[model samples]
Target: MDRPRRCVLLKFGELALKGRNRPRFVNALERNLRRMTADLGPIEVRHRGGVFIVSGDMPQEELAERCLGLPGVSVVQPALRCERDATAAADAAVELLRELPGHTFAVRATRRDKRFALRSIELARLLGDAVRVRLGLDVDLSNPDLELFVEVDHKELLVSVERLRGAGGLPVGTSGRALVLLSGGLDSPVAAYRMMKRGLRCDFVHFSGRPFTSPESIYKAYALVGRLDRFQGDSRLYVVTFGPAQRRLATAGAGRLQVLSQRRLMVRVAAALGERLDAGALVTGDSLGQVASQTLPNLAVVEEAAQLPLLRPLIDRDKSEIVDAARALGTYDISILPDEDCCQLFTSKPASTRGHPDDLRRIERTADIEELVEQLAESAELFHPTLEERAMVSAATPASRGPSLG
Candidate 1:
């Protein structure tokens, strides 16, 4: 047998059905798996029996944690499994279960290893019965305090009792890097998750309309990113102060174009930062024709501000879709937190549904938005990932040194 740390099995859902797209998704997942682990160490991925098995001497749990947005992967699990010889497999299960915290137990088996000659139910019962005798614990088949799960693959039978909740998306950094125009809004984070599911590495460039708004908003925004950063790599934040920029642009008679102008500036800031961050595009969590600002005309005006490609993963999506995604990605709770962001600052009464590029171009003629942008960017706060030593997230940075308030 190989060393104990030799292999970790990565099982995927949703990607299995697409016969042709499957390969591309697999390739993307592999690339992301590597990028997220660039700081970790070496690892190898092998494809067998429709599941990807990762082998390495590095931290399997850490690698698994970093793989929240890995494309094509539904879940990531680290475990040891072998041929389904009931007596032997049960013995291994018993040993592993003993290492966990609590003990009232049960074993669940999913038999796809036909050669084992036992139904999944029977296999589970046999293993459960064996563990009960070995560990001297009573079994509550309905729901034992501790569950030992046995998943039977074609070539191997995997045994694991505990599963960690993963970021539960595609691998981060697989699709390409994208600088998300992350407003501290409920929708944008969810949108970022949608894009990440396709394998995009995301870094946030948050725009703060400071002075007009308090730093508390930026704190809220970064707090939201902290939750997201758990799945993405290192959770880096680039804060851009839009206060002076917005004031200058607005004083120059940029009223109807205020929102559009602000968005353009944000796009420009994100583009510049994206280059520095090695990101490929800009992502916004806007739904199609939902808000007055999101109307086709308004969206076109705002999008023109960015030189790089713009990705609106949530553009065509609905509120239900956004909420569902938010809830599923685990950003829902924090997003609903009572923290205010820049968007709430200028809640325009009767906001614009149609914005003309001509108006934006006209505004560009007066106020030097770019110069203000430069000044703000220069004065911006920079942060780095609180690098950890172990594969598992033993600890994270304290909230004190985290991203500053708006």
Candidate 2:
């Protein structure tokens, strides 16, 4: 009549491959897990061999689900923990497996604690026999209808029947930080997500066509960042009103180079903001040849204005691939909503696919680029997409100090 205690088990993926720096990776993963689940009250993560046993007052499945989205975690299993005795383990396994649908099962046991009374094979046999006798199930080693795993640690044994896949990568904060040029579009959100999966924690900067356009784009960008915040907490979004700058570029008679010039100026503003925040790089959603401004030569022209490394995570991906990723990431619906993006403004002619950097420099000289960058950076409004202190995102900068068209 003994019932097993509920717990959660976590397994690593690439972190296990780190030979000498394994401890650092493991510690980071553990720390991230603890911080992610801190709202569930006091929780303890016990490292046993390659698995982490998480025990708390909350439901085991809930804990497992939360850990599934975290980076560096490969598998999450809602498990039952019992004393290190064959009878206890067998009872736990049977009780847990009763809810699962299967005619055949296999008990895979790992004895990390050598001091345990039974060997791994013996424990598996014992547990399998108990299931066969009590539950009337057959055993199939190679391809079983169900799988029951028993992990023997120094203090206890964990029995689980379900293994859930997790977000497999290095933990966030391990790769360093970057600023994402998040637009209210499908591709940029996916780009941010890809970078997050690669261990880069990101803040966001959005260019909005305010004073000349509606605030719809700002809402979409905020919502997109809010969705992405679930993967990495502490996300901030900076809004820079870019209508006036776009107008300046247009009136300067840089007709064919309008889009490229706007992109360059946007990067310049992002780079300036990134420098003040100590970010090492800037992330963009530019896929190669997706649009005129994203073409090879045009992209190079835009890159000329950035002070930091401009990372395009979606450079080689197709639009279909990017859309699929966005749908899977839960950002597609928000991104598809109607919005007036800054780039959509002031384009009277087709963008030049092969923009020369010298032409862009001449166009930029018509305006006080440094003063405009300073005003854009200083007047930028900040938003906390994930935290509780989030405020309403203002579309326009302060009237007294707003950057204007030259």
Candidate 3:
């Protein structure tokens, strides 16, 4: 006979506290899970109590990796389903424990279905003796080398020897959509990841220094979005040609305020794009004092250009923290790639650390700000990395299944 299908148990952490909006958040999480695991195979997702039970004939390792990228998921465990009986639960626990590498073990039994005869402690004691006798594994209740978790819910029982940590946060799409100002740098990608972790579904808008610079930045942006799409399943990137605007600012002699002027323009353009995409806000990688343009005064001046809310996820994080986050998100190597992004093309002296509103107004007068924003909005190129394309890319590259951030 064929073996029983492997199952994964998904637990929601903060989503359970959503009260009235719990259904909506749970639905969104279910939809995201379906999309993320579509390539795996035919699967079944059932909501029992507050837990999501996923069953399919796929590799648990791959499923766990995909689950960790999903927001709202706190834990994913490869589980075995059995009838709600003490002997069956003990058999399942012993079967799983036999495969795990551990001499000391513990059985944690949770009796969610109170109608069952035995309580949690009684069930644990009963299963513990059975496991110890069958597997000869010493019991370590305080700190076990391996833990076999058993959950009795209604008429079913699920048992697992290991539970993997998930990407804990609100489910993506539960918060809303935002357009991230994606740059070919470490910080922006990390910022985007942070927003995603907070349940924001992010679309990207990358400013490319094409024509005047190499296409390396554009490629880097593509790679970064590709990496991020692994989390969201689908992603859209809008590449806007920004060299003309930079040259225009240079020709108009913006002086020391060039960087600040460029930032304001980028914000305006991103705001325009955000409107078109119906994004709730604009996300950037600006950390306080990280760069000259990121100073408090310049940030304030630049904020005036955005019509919508501006979210800087990395505002207070230092460089080392940002780099570590980037590495964890798998974008550090790609971000470290040499590229002439729009921010690097212009040669200017030390930028003003405190850009005044009057200075911004004077700089705005040199260029038709409204016209430039409109032009960028009209001339941007959009790219959508579909699920099939992403799967193809993953299959072609053997390293796509490398260690997950979690």
The number of the candidate with the highest TM-score is 3
Where does model 3 exceed 4 Å of error?
1-5, 387-406
Reference-based lDDT, each prediction: 0.70, 0.84, 0.83
What does candidate 3's lDDT look like per residue over 178-207, in tens digits? Answer: 999998799999988889889999999998
Q: In model 3, how large is the Cα lDDT of residue 58?
A: 86
| Model 2: colliding residue pairs | none
TM-score of 2: 0.90
Q: Residues 1-406, candidate 1, lDDT per residue (tens digit)?
A: 3212324666777656557566776776676667666777888777765567776767666766665445556666667656546776787687778767665887777765566688888888888888888787788877678888787766666777656544445555646788887787678888777777777878887787777776654654666677666455576778887776777777777776677777887887778778777888999987888877898988888888887899998888889878888787666765665544565444445666787887887787788767765666566666553324112121233235244343
Q: Return the candidate ranking by TM-score, descending.
A: 3, 2, 1
Candidate 2 lDDT tens digits, 225-335: 878887778788999988898888888877888888888888899999998998999999999999988889888888889999999989999999998998888788778
Worst 10 residues of 2 by lDDT: 397-406
Per-candidate TM equals 0.67, 0.90, 0.92
lDDT pick, better of 1 and 3:
3
Native-referenced Cα lDDT, model 3: 0.83
- Find the candidate with the highest lDDT and give its number: 2
